[model samples]
Target: MKNKQLTFFLMAALFLIPMQVKAEQVNLYAAGSLRAALGDVAKAFEAEIGNQVATEFGPSGLLRQRIEQGEAAHVFASANMEHPQNLVGQGQKGPVALFTRNNLCALAQPGQTVTTATLLDVMLDPAVRVGTSTPKADPSGDYAFELFGKADQLKSGSTAILTAKALLLTGGPDSPKAPEGRNLYAWVMDEQKADVFLTYCTNAVLAKKELSGLQIISIAPELSVGADYGLLVLDGASQEAWRLALFILSPEGQKILGDYGFVVGGLPAKP
Candidate 1:
């Protein structure tokens, strides 16, 4: 009887030990723009590895500030290279990978017909409103500013006109939220706050998918700008964090980003 009882206890311990081990969770911080694609990737990774991924999504700069303030996060996925390189500069030794690229686009409000040729003109109309994310806090806004600068080159003083008329609506602490909807941009448009917004093509796609009657006006190549996304694992991160970072850098991960409308190829070589 004593031998049988000892064996039973040993068997129970084996079951409990692995369960406890699998309870470990990986914390990941990603740019708001990556939410849809990364969320799916995280789900797959968790199922395959038997671990949980807790994600925090926000503007790249805001997320960077959180990490710099010592907020508990293992991986940082940024909308641009600057924030991650800043982390590496501060002593986090990790290979910075350029994982994806996104281009600027104009998301027009419902029934607002516009083409690439007429994009700047439509936005410039005194009657039409324009929305943009906050500069410095969100790379999307910075990209918009660059496009505006290009417009200035096309027509002298156009940049100042656009800047003066533009509304800084997204990316900061006062960023707008979707009305219990899947697409955040749709809600902003529904509010009639702006007739159009300058953001990434990927984000515009997301908005179109979630809302009907939205038109995406491509930016002409001559005046177009693209954003490069960066990913890195901070020093002192858990083994799980490192694993996730590697998984995201893997080819399989690149496919996920591509499916979400990121330009998968033609990026700088991965580190």
Candidate 2:
């Protein structure tokens, strides 16, 4: 009888030990471009750490604005360093880390006559409707305008011409929402919003997958702009949030980002 009671008590304590390791929840706000990749990363983290990750995806700039406005979040991943750096300037925390990289690309409608060499002329064509996200509200748009600035270096007055003619089609509060489970760039092209849209290469790849035959044209080096993604943990966040940040910079997480066509380079050695 004594032996049986001791065995039962040990079993009960063993079961209760697992319960004592209470799971934590990490709130994450990230750039819309990271939706697929980060979703996978979050799943992997949850499985490994037994913690819940609540994610919100949107334009990086707008997400930063929300965080600045007192919305509680554990981590923030921005498309460009500027937005996260802005938070650091405001005393968010230290050591804003670069997690991934992306490059500008042109997503052309099906059968559009465009290529790396001819991309400039095709975009310059007065009849071609060029689309861009809202500058300052999204880093993709800022990169698009930066590409335009490079174009000016190649051909005088190109910036004025491109910026003046470009259509702000997405990444704004007033922008039309894409259909459920539809890629915004693909849907915009399907709706005939523009003949050519300037966006991230990763976005172009996803758009092409969604809308078959949509062309993903690489920008020439002269006009190419690369985006640096930044990762930040807010001051006073749970340790689980920092763990999520480290997981994103881990080899597994970077592999997931690379598999999604993002340029994963220059990452710090994993600790």
TM-score of each: 0.88, 0.91
User: In model 1, how large is the Cα lDDT of residue 9?
Assistant: 98
Worst 10 residues of 1 by lDDT: 15-24
**Stretch of 10 with least lDDT, candidate 2:** 15-24
Kindly report which residue stretches of model 1 are placed more than 4 angstroms away from their true locations once superposed: 1-20, 266-271
- Which residue pairs come into collision in candidate 1? none
Scored by Cα lDDT, where does model 2 land? 0.92
Q: Please, what are the lDDT tens digits per residue for candidate 1 over residues 1-271?
A: 9999999999998887855455578899999999999998898789878779999998999999999999988899999999999989988897888888889999998778688999988888999999999888999998898889999878888899998998999898778766654577777776777898999999998888877778888999878999999989888888988889877877777788889998885335668
Quickly count the clashes in candidate 1: 0
The residue-by-residue lDDT of candidate 2 on 204-245, one tens digit each, is 999999898899998998999999999999998989999999
Q: For all candidates, what are the clash counts?
A: 0, 0
Best by TM-score: 2
